[model samples]
Structure formats: C-alpha cells, structure tokens
Target: MLKSTMNQNKVQTLKGFRDFLPEAMAVRNYVKNLLIDTFETFGFEPIETPTLEYSSVLMGKYGDEADKLVYSFTDNGDRQIGMRYDLTVPTAKVLAMYSQTIPMPFKRYQIQPVWRAENTQKGRYREVLQCDIDTFGTNSPIADAEILAVINTVLQKLNFKTFTILINSRIVLNNILKACKITEDKNSILQSLDKFSKIGQDGVTKELIGKNIPKAKITVLFKYIKQAQPDEYLQNVINQLKILGVSKNNYQFDPTIVRGLDYYTGPIFETVVTKPK
Candidate 1:
C-alpha cells in the first residue's frame, strides 16, 4: 500500500533555518562570490573539509557555552560526532592530516555554513554561513596586517561603511581576570560575560553568581572590564599596524570583548555594523 499524503513528512525546513528562494539565493551567491574573489586576490587559496567532525575534535576549543550549543550525537558505531561549528578547527585538523603534503605557512580560505544549536536572534540562526581566511606557521606581524587589510577590503567591496573593528587580546583579558582571583574557569566566566551585550551586566552577574564566582569577585572583575586596556602588547600591535599603513579610524579598543573561544590564545577582533537599527 502507498503511504498517505497526510502521513508523509511535511516539506518544511527546521526552526532557525529557512528555505532560500531564488532571489535570496542569488544575493547569497553574489556576496559569497565577492568574498571569494577578495580572498583569492589576497593570495589565500581555497580549501574544503567535511561538515561533520568528531565531537572530541571540536569540543573544549570553543569554551563551555559554545560547546553546549554544538549539535552532537553518538553514531551507530558509538563514536561521538558533531557538525562543524566553525571552520578554524577543521582546518587545523586538515593541516595535521595532510602535513606531509601541505607546505609550510599554509594560507587558506574556506567558505561554508556552520551549525550551533542555540536560540536564534534576528539574522542569527542555528545554522549560519561563514567566510574565513586563515594562515598558519607564522608569527609575523605582517600576516596580521594582511588579515586586517583583507577584512577592510571585503567590507569595502561589499559597500559597507561606518563599521567598527573591535579588537582585544585573550592574553590581556586573562591577566586582568587572574588578578581578580578568577584563577580558573576563565573561559566559563568569559563565556558568561560574552552575553553582556545581549543580557546586560545584571544578567552576566547572575550567570557568574550561579557559577559560584564570588559576588565580590564579579564586582572586582567588572570594574577592570569597564576600564581601558592596560595591556601594552595590543597597543604595540596597533602602533605596528599603523606603521604598516592600515587605517586607525576603525580600530576600537574594547576590553569587554573577550571572545568565548578557549583556543584564542592571543588577539581577537570582530567587525560590527554600526548602522542604526
């Protein structure tokens, strides 16, 4: 007997996801192609990886709150598997797997969709597209400048103006937090504070309080978080970049911008559209 139409699965996409109609897809393709061209122009070669990776490989890298949002499951073989949350970790894995074949100082660009099972906000979803360019095996300041240039190029090419590039250093934030008696669970605390923009100071206070971080400790930490960055390393980086001829107009030194990724050992930055909502 044939299955009844009523009993069939509905042709609907999951929550936090949507069907991209032709027009929307066209716009997406145009933007993605533009980004790809920009990356290639900067000498970043393209690379791809599997969308699914071992949960073990992804976990403990993005910190606690992020790990909680990973779409993970145990396969029939009893191996824990997870969808890629970001492109960086998988690229590291690819480099490790093909180290013999890959050359030193690999410069690669990967464009793909990443998954994170969380409450979707406007223009943010459980699954979202990402375009990334990464370089490894180098500690040169020039590499950092090229990255900033690529970012500026991509945004300018997309006709974006009035955007701010907020920069911070995990090492700096970690030092400040350590002085606050938060000698451990730093990522958990950082992840909690990561919600400050969305949930406000009181919300972050509540989260850290629930984490058993002393109220006094949170108070001390928030004090320094609101202050200007006392770390000179990032300041020196800024000066170097200025010497490299990158514009200082878009640079913002936001101490509270502790990215919730455990693997971020040094500097971290994000571009924000400052247009009025």
Candidate 2:
C-alpha cells in the first residue's frame, strides 16, 4: 500500500495545453526578448496583474463566446474567482486602482500567458500567451497609428516573411445596422457577424434567424458586409497609418473582420500570417 501510494499514477497534461521543452522554450524566450525591445521603443512599460481575479470584475466584460471560455471557480475563502482571460480587463482594473499615481496617457505592454477554456482546435488553445499593448487617456488617431506601426515592426523584426494586417471598424457595422433600420438587436447582430469567419455566411444567417432577425434584414447585412464601406471611411483610416510610415502593402481595411467582442467600439486589427512556420 505504501509503495502504491508512493507511485501514484503520474498525471497527464490537461487537454489543449502543452509542456514547452527546452528547444521550444529557448525559441519562445528569444521571441519574447525581441517583443519587449520593440514595446520599449514605443514608450510602453511592463505591468502585470494576478492570474486570479474576483468574478465580479471579469464577469461580463467579454461577450457570450468569451464568457464560456473563462475558467471560474470558488476558492477556499468562499469567494468566486476567475483566471485572467486576457490582459485587457486586468489592465483596466489596474488603471482604475492606480489612476491617482500613474501618469496620464499611460502606455503599457503586457507579455503574459492568459487562460481560456476554449474549444481546442488547430491554431487555438486553452492556454496561450497574449502580448498586448494599450494606451489610456487618448482618443487620438496618432495613438491608433502608433499601435499599427509597432505591430508591423514586431512582425518584420521577428523575420516573418509574409503577413498582412487586417483592420476593421465595429462602428461601420453599427452604421450599417442603423441604416438598415436594425435598432433593437445590434448586439446580437454583431455577435452573429463575428462568427462569420468560423461559420461562413450561411451559418451567420442561421444564427441571426435563431435570434429572430427578419430574413430580409439579414440579406441586406450580408450585402453590406460584402460591399466596401463608404470610400471616405476606408481612406481616412489608411491615411492615418500612412502618416505613421506603415507600409501600405502590409495593412488593409477589411469589413468582414469584426473582432469577436461586444465591447470593442472602434477599430480592430489583427496580423494574419500568410506563410506560417
């Protein structure tokens, strides 16, 4: 019995996670250092938050999909706690707490591992590293430009050969919905639209219909999504990034790339690796 106890079966790695062997860890550290240097060049200082947060603080910040991916539990103290799903919310909490002490227009970069109880799939994981940079106290176009510039630099510096940055605005969708007279269910509409990449147009139509959106309006929405937004809106965003010296070839205005978050009120961007290693 004592021998059996001593040899209690070795636990397996939980699904959707992995152990980073030395070879991989070395590569990861090398990339991390490069990112840290890039972040510092743009005046971003590093800050960290606890992995566990009170459920009240993180409960509803993300929409339905994210809410499902959060890992929540009751700790021994009988308090509801949740693992940090992303760096954004915890940074917001920190900013509110240190508002008096921190300088206005604070710039920060956080290179941290975030937990997500998401469906494990190729290119998706339950635990992943999120390298995020954010600025508070500014609504400046230059701020947005700087972010795009930094990301473009990071990818190039990392020796990635083929990539493009896709940018879109949630406001564009809101405007389209308003123009289509879709007043009450804008949130539901955005949520459905977010699923387009994963589920395609037919699946989004199904989701919208499930929410009881009229088929006519859904048809109009697909058309609007396919059509380019007013040329002025597209050019305006492009002009800002151009002003910051980002390569025109490296970025584009894609209307279909609505980020899957209800709280995003403005521009959203992502880097797509065309040539994955």
Which candidate has the highest lDDT of all? 2
Tell me the number of clashing residue pairs for each predicted model: 0, 0
Clashing pairs in 1: none
After aligning candidate 1 to the native by TM-score, how far in Å is the CA of 87 from where it should be? 0.8
Give the alpha carbon lDDT tens digit for every residue of 1-277 in model 2: 8668656976568989989999999999999999999999999999999999999888799977688889999999999999999999999999989999999798999988999997788988889999999888887667777888899999999888888998887777777777788865677678777777779999999988999898998898788778857345445667888777889889877777777766788888877888665
> In candidate 1, what are the lDDT values of residues 142-162, reduced to their tens digit?
676677778877777788766
Off by over 4 Å in 2: 1-8, 198-203, 206-211, 227-237
Give stretches of model 1 more than 4 Å off.
1-10, 74-79, 119-121, 199-216, 230-232
In terms of lDDT, the poorest run of 10 residues in model 2 is: 228-237
> What would the TM-scores of all predictions be?
0.85, 0.89
lDDT for each candidate structure:
0.83, 0.84
What TM-score, to 2 decimals, does candidate 2 have?
0.89
